[model samples]
Target: MSEDDRTRAMRSPGDGRPLPQRPADGLRSGGAPAHRMPGGGPGAPTHQLPNAAPQGPPESGPKPGGSRVYGRERSGSSPIKPLRSRREPSESGPPSPRGPGRRISGRTVLKIVAGVLVVLLVTVVGLFFWVNSRLAGIDGVLADYEGRPADTPGTNWLLVGSDSRKGLTAAQRKKLATGQAAGQRTDSMMLLHIPEGSDKPTLVSLPRDSAVTIPGKGRDKLNSAYALGGPKLLVRTVESVTGVYVDHYMEIGFAGFVDIVDAVGGVEINVRQAVDDPKAGLKLKKGTQVLSGSQALGYVRTRKGGALPDFERTKRQRQFLSAVVKKAASPGVLINPFTAIPLASSATAAVEVDSGTGAFDMLSLGLAMGDSPVTTVVPFGGNEAVPSGGTAVKWDRMKALALFDALKNDKPVPKDVIDAG
Candidate 1:
């Protein structure tokens, strides 16, 4: 070989120069010919076709680090483009606030609480209307008397307890020891007066045997008006005698009274003395005792033996009525729907109210009674035998008038009237 050709063949491949061609036979130490380097050496030109029709896929060949991706060898400049998975994000850092696995905040909890409260309020309101619709309403139970006393300053409610066995079954009658009374009569009567602006409520019990002139039936026992013309005449008679207007009237009968007592479980009362009365089937010992429905019925009905029979009985009726109000308003009954719903149903079904009395009026009466109002029986005067073979009660006229006046004018009842109890 010539000196210059030999020098070219000995040059390193890094010189970016082509190797000198070998002899026709082969390299001196030879086997097969060596492959050409990529990005051809300096002496060899880099061929470029002018505006080549987007060249087809490059030919396959072995690479140094890994298999060739296209025509280019795997290198730092030529990255292996990763194949994307369906679940992986296109570009990533951290998840968004509304994305999966977000934490709950206080505002969210408050919103949830508010939503629940609104739902409960709506439910309670709906339930109230449904229950109010169930009330038993009456018409014209109040008399339309032109001579009726003028309306007074406070609200007046005349509450009556009747001895009516109209709805009692044979078993119930036997259980309650109530003989089958053919007709209804007032066994107990009272007036509850509530003055405006938080004045104390006064509960005045009217004796059934009070000597009063009935509007149509003159000079009869107070209870006789109820038997003759029902509630209208009774209210009329009371109005004429007391000179105090009757704003609302409420009454309950035997079966209904018993059911209400039982529905509230029972009423607790303090009895100062022991009593055993076979006529009313009331057997009780002194001290406080909780009376069941049947026992309580007898307690209010018995008027046999006491200092004054009917007067003492009226006191007991007042006590029991007050206890009933307390029990119906108690937390255990009011907070539990099971107890509250049935008790309200029993009370509304049991009572007969005047035409003007609405559901709200009844509820207001109940709440007022629950306050443990000042309870007193009418001032007693004397007892006289009647032509009808029974005795009539006479009221202490002047004192009674003063008591009614205090109530009519919304004044505190005279201490004398209260002390008389």
Candidate 2:
């Protein structure tokens, strides 16, 4: 084509529109060469070109249509704002409200419960040790002797209540009506037999004034053996007469008896008749009633109720002891910290056990006693006068032997022997 025709084709007809400028690199602003309109004449369709680049070095900014140009801004266009990432919260606005806290998993809850149980177990074990250490022990009280009875099928415990004012003050002694005695004497004695089989335990009361042959001394009142030689001779005398071995020995004095009863919050007893014994400091009406420590001590010590005072007293002793032990071992007291702690402290401190017996043995004793054992006094023939000892009760040899043999063989006592007692 002729140069004049090419030049005319690039320009617009008669209306005089401005011509597009070339960039510094000799190309159009869009980096493409200009193309001519298809029908090269006036009034024909033409391709529109972008505006020329601004003066000065090409702008490091957005182009005319608000499009980003190399991550820069243009003077007459709104700059393209970078997109906000999800991870980056907006700093210009107020803070968002907090949602609910994360929930704890079931596994975490189990772990917390297990931790609490471990703490409770540790605390219980510590308490057991502390209470066990408080039990009072007696040396050689159950020492083996050459002629001591052999081990029987059942466990035997010799429980002794002594008229000892060792720890009582003047006022206490006066209040308890326990005369000032120079030496300790037996107030009550009982043999508790716990069979290995499911049979219930048996508790037999031995009258203090019964005539029995002491080891070295001849025939005398049963309590005379204790006064002659301490617990050793007394154990020997009882064993020789009963022919049943004594496995454990426990003793409590008058003051200790009171403390134990009071510690357990008192014991309930059904009195058979009215009794007012000034000598024993006991006064009560007939019926069921709760007895405090001081009142319990007197109730068990009094020999003033039935025709046979000593027998009635023994019955009273057994009744009161069983009630108190049951209460002490009951869940209502054991599960309660207030009652359990004081009962443990007072009972352990007050009672004295043989060297071989531990806190567990004592606990077993309480549990066995609380089982409502068959209670009865030793079978007695009648009262008798001895040469050295004053008037004393005599045991019926035949019935007594049957009862002890039953205990030795771990068999139930003969019904006739139980009835005789």
Candidate 3:
């Protein structure tokens, strides 16, 4: 065949393109044969079209030492790069600069703390309202009368302990040795004076058997005022006698007294002497010890210890009351939920306060009593026989007047009168 005809026959039949000429060295760039010979032998020339793009250097192939370079290989067309994964960065370059991760600022932290405090404050406020609402109020106990004593410099509270069996069951009354009394009478009375200044408070006991003039009832034992006219008449009688205004009134019955004493666990008391009184249901040893509810009630009520039984009873009452107030206001009781809740419940349920008095006033009373108040009793002359009210104790007029005057003007009691009592 002619040379031109043989070359034409070497062209690709499908595209009618001429094949590439073998280089003179008879090898590819990497020293490998480009294609197979006509009979599938080595050392054949690679095919290429005349008008095709010029080939560049080999992008990947075997190297001089038989190690291969890994990359995109070139053809008559442009090189195609391998696809990269979205998660992985390119190994051919440094990773792109990234922004810092999110962080919490100081302001944000403060906002979180403030939110927590607000929630706690709301909870505390709600608890206060709930507890305050439980207080039982008595109406018109401190009503203004025509000749009532004028308001004094400091606060005065008329604290009355009544022998009312309103809440006590038969078994309880029997246990407490409280007879089946139909109507209630004042078992004990006290005037608690809280000075506005830094002076310590004063607690003065009013013996129930003392002779005092009850308005519209003439002269009789002081307790007869309460038995005849209840709280209103009793307050009037006390104010008229002492010349000191009564700002608040609180009364607790037998059952209430017991409940309160037990609620604070018990009250610590130092007994002056041993007493065994079956009538008052009190039998105690002399020493510093704690008294339970029933024992405390009897301890304060028994008139069997000193030569002047009633006088000694009044001292015991004052001593016990102050100790109880201190216990109720202690951190151990106020901060502990178990004791605090029960104490609050018992206290609020146990006492009847004037309409004007509230939980805050009671709190003030507790705080005042916890201050270790100076305790005394009305200076007395001697026992007397009253035609209408049996035997009654008589107060020393001059000394009693001086004591009440000091309290009315918010001045300290004269040391002579304090010692006299």
Off by over 4 Å in 2: 1-117
lDDT of 1 by residue, 231-258 (tens): 8888888888988888999889988898
Give TM per candidate.
0.73, 0.74, 0.73
* lDDT value, candidate 1, whole model: 0.79
How high is the lDDT of residue 334 in model 2? 81
Pairs with steric clashes in candidate 2: 61-73, 62-74
Error of 2 at 121 (Å): 3.0
Better of 2 and 3 by lDDT: 3
lDDT (tens digit, per residue) of candidate 3 on 1-421: 9996886676646686655455533344434444434554333445444444433343455333343224423234443456777767666665555624346679999999999899878865765676679878889888887977789899999999999988889999999999897998999999999999999999999999999888999889999999899999999999999999999999999999999999999999999899899988989999999999999999999999788888899999999999999999998998677888888888888999898887788889999999999999999977788769478999999999999999999999999999988
> Weakest 10 consecutive residues, lDDT, candidate 2?
21-30
Which is the leading candidate under lDDT? 3
Q: Candidate 3 has what TM-score?
A: 0.73
TM-score computed on alpha carbons, candidate 1: 0.73
**lDDT tens digits, residue span 338-413, model 2:** 8888888888878888778877788899899889999888999778888785799999998899999999999999
- Highest TM-score, which number? 2
RMSD in Å for model 1? 11.6
